[model samples]
Target: MSTPSPSSSEDVRRTRILSSKLYFDVPPSKVPLIYSSAYNIAFLGMEKLHPFDSSKWGRICQFLVSAGILDKRCIVEPEEASREDLLVVHSEKYLDSLKSSMTVAKIVEVPPVAMLPNCIIQRKVLDPFRKQVGGSVLASKLAKERGWAINVGGGFHHCSAEKGSGFCAFADISLSIHFAFVRLNISRVMIIDLDAHQGNGHELDFAKDRRVYILDMFNSEVYPLDFNARRHIHQKVELLSGTTTDVYLKKLDEALEVAGRMFNPELIVYNAGTDVLDGDPLGCLRISPDGIIKRDEKVFTFARSKGVPILMLTSGGYMKSSARVIADSIINLSTKCLIEMQGEQNTS
Candidate 1:
């Protein structure tokens, strides 16, 4: 079969995004923060083999609820992204490749998953990721409408249209942006990817697209070291493995100033990955819990001051303490008036 031209594939992608139900209207009672119970991945003991905290998404919400920062009833639930929705950014062949149990095991980096049947993997693992993808897409719409929105379970920045890696099986970030372009009428987006690992997936997807400006700050010594994708970052900030919070924040301040001057974006996509916490085995950075709070504050304050709608995705922090830190950072955002919680009238 002949490969489709870029323009033809773009047309098909636009059609899929336009027809997706992921961008449904959220009521006033429900917050723009998107999540669902289905976001958690729990299966036969296979999930235990991975270092990732599969239930961290649920735990984040649990902390928020227990702390009285948010009500369980006010949380917005997202529908799963169907196959048609996946086609917006993912290729048909790429989606088909996921049918193999070994393919999934490789993407998620879990050896035991390769032993399970594809049917079980699809139902238990991939389905949760699909729901998170839906949440990410819906978050863009909600952000455009409400000035800011948060998806408690997204920011799969290591997956691209044609490949998956670093425990990310779907291109949620790319899918979200495409949905915003077609459905929300957004033209310019600034991606502030602060994950400990390089956001190679989205960088590769938007490599030549001038509509998106990427500001990525990641540990220089990490997995999936893609030199090709590094070329796409507009403001690439590389940190050492054991960099302290002070140095990290200082660099971020400088980077944010440069980013603001370079791109007048209509939307800001903030990938707030808590993996940079001091004890995270994978992240290797020495940032404290307070540093994480201040980091989020700085990003939200930057976007708010620029008058750009910001969408935050909780990405790539699966440590045991990640949920509590994330919940605390979110609470800090609320207390500092950087973001309004659900059920409250949005004054911004």
Candidate 2:
């Protein structure tokens, strides 16, 4: 049998995807969904001092890839901050600090890993977020051109303008928004942040931008120092602790209605965090795994009804070892949602 050249194999399209952009770091450990069902997946990770090893993310990636959720060919790992791109939302100093912490590993004083071994390595594993900017930039562009598409692992919305927070090292969502406006001819954007924690980072970045409309569903008193009044000067809702899934869903229904009435977005960006699972260490609201599924279904359904594309990003969820399971569940729901939304659209 003759061997196919690597370049020839590279030209093969794996699936009939509505999109072609799922990113993983060079190290498979950096991709959480690689283990689920490796269809429509890509490896974009690197073997740096990534939190991947610490998080058993490599195992998670294997599971997703083995399960056939993440297709391996679309992988795209990268290095360094996007010089001009980082300037869109993050300050030069913060970008420098991010590089310093990962390069020399000497400037990192706050992280639990303290020195964060292999600064260069850390940057490699964390490549997904920056590429997320590119992925979502592509997703949004596709949404504009084809009506729907997706970019997994792009919603690190908790990080702020000045610094990183809640394990989020990059501001993928904000950067993507800027990319859309600057490169994709997009404005009048809407971000529906359902990460279970206030999207304080987004609030700080988009609070004054007239083109962005943010709807946040989070516990008021959570990590990362949120300013409730300013969090959504335009529109904010703080769900209390001990709130059940039913109530949360009802409130979400209402919130979705409000978003529809007020923003009527042409492009919808959803921060679908699975941390809302009752046992999530960082979340205040007690929602179940099934509840998380329902939440995503509703959000995707609503966005589809408006005849728009939803750029879904994975944001905050800190369940340690359960991270893989949590990640799988989120992607599972997300995959199922694409089916449901298409069905709903076809029927309608």
Candidate 3:
């Protein structure tokens, strides 16, 4: 078979992105916070085995609603990304590999998942992930239209085009950027990854692509110590395991300043992972709950100052407390006037 030229491949990708239903227009009455109950993963007590809070997405929304920070009726539900959407970034071989129960179990790090049939695994785990991928993809469009958006799920940054790792089954971050490139007519994107672990997936995918600038602030001693991928980061801030809240925030401020000087992007994709909390075993950092809130405020403030649209994705947080912290941060953002959770009033 003859290899497709780069231009041909670009044409194919554009076609897939244009034909995708995942980028449907959300109503003005709805807030740009993208979420769906289907974003949560739980079935047969299998979720208990993983260190992650599988139902974190739903719990975050529940907390927001209980606190009256968000109106549940106005939340936008994204369509699940179809196989065609997945093909926009994923290789046919990689998508096919997901069919095996073993491959999925290894990627998600759930040993028992290998024993269950692929069909069950698909419904319970991968389906939820795909829905989050849809949310991530749609968030960029919403952010462009509304100045800001938050996908309560997504940030599967460990999965690249041809691989999945560290509980990331799909490359939602890369998929969203690709969708934005074609559908939104956006050429410049900046990925601000504040996850505890490095976002090696998107880093590798955009390694040679100058259109995307990455500012990755992650613990240097964590799960995905990908030195090769580290080279791709336009601005890399590596922190020690026991780095405190003050130190983390200081580094973030400096990084954002430098990033602002380096790249002028039209959109910012913020991977706001709560795993940086002091108690997180994986993150190992000593950032407090209030610190996470402050960190989010700083990023949003930066985006606002630059007059750039920003989209947030809840990435990797293994603790049960992550949901509460995330909800609190969103509330803080609203209090700071960085985001408006209340839907736009229809004056018509």
Each model's Cα RMSD:
2.0, 11.5, 0.8
Worst 10 residues of 1 by lDDT: 339-348
Q: List, residue by residue over 247-324, the lDDT tens digit for candidate 3.
A: 999999999999999999999999999999988978999999999999999999999999999999999998999999
lDDT of 2 by residue, 1-348 (tens): 997685554233122111223322233222212111211112232222232223333444455557666544433232223555555567668877765544323221233244445454344434544555555545555455445544545566667667776556667677667656644556778988888777777778787788999888877677545665254635676777767899999999999998888886767878877667687766767887677777877887887788876766655565654356544654665487553222111232
Model 1 TM-score on a 0 to 1 scale: 0.97
Model 1 clashing-pair count: 0
User: Candidate 3: where are CA atoms >4 Å away?
Assistant: none
lDDT of 2 at 99: 51
Question: Against the unseen true structure, what C-alpha lDDT does each candidate score?
Answer: 0.92, 0.58, 0.95
Better of 1 and 3 by TM-score: 3
By lDDT, who's the top model here? 3
| lDDT at position 12, candidate 1 | 85
TM agreement with the true structure for every prediction:
0.97, 0.71, 0.99
Best by TM-score: 3
Q: What value of lDDT does candidate 2 attain over all alpha carbons?
A: 0.58
Model 1, span 155-250: residue lDDT tens: 999999999999899999998998999888899999999989999999999999999999999998987689999999999999999999999999
lDDT score, residue 70, model 1? 92
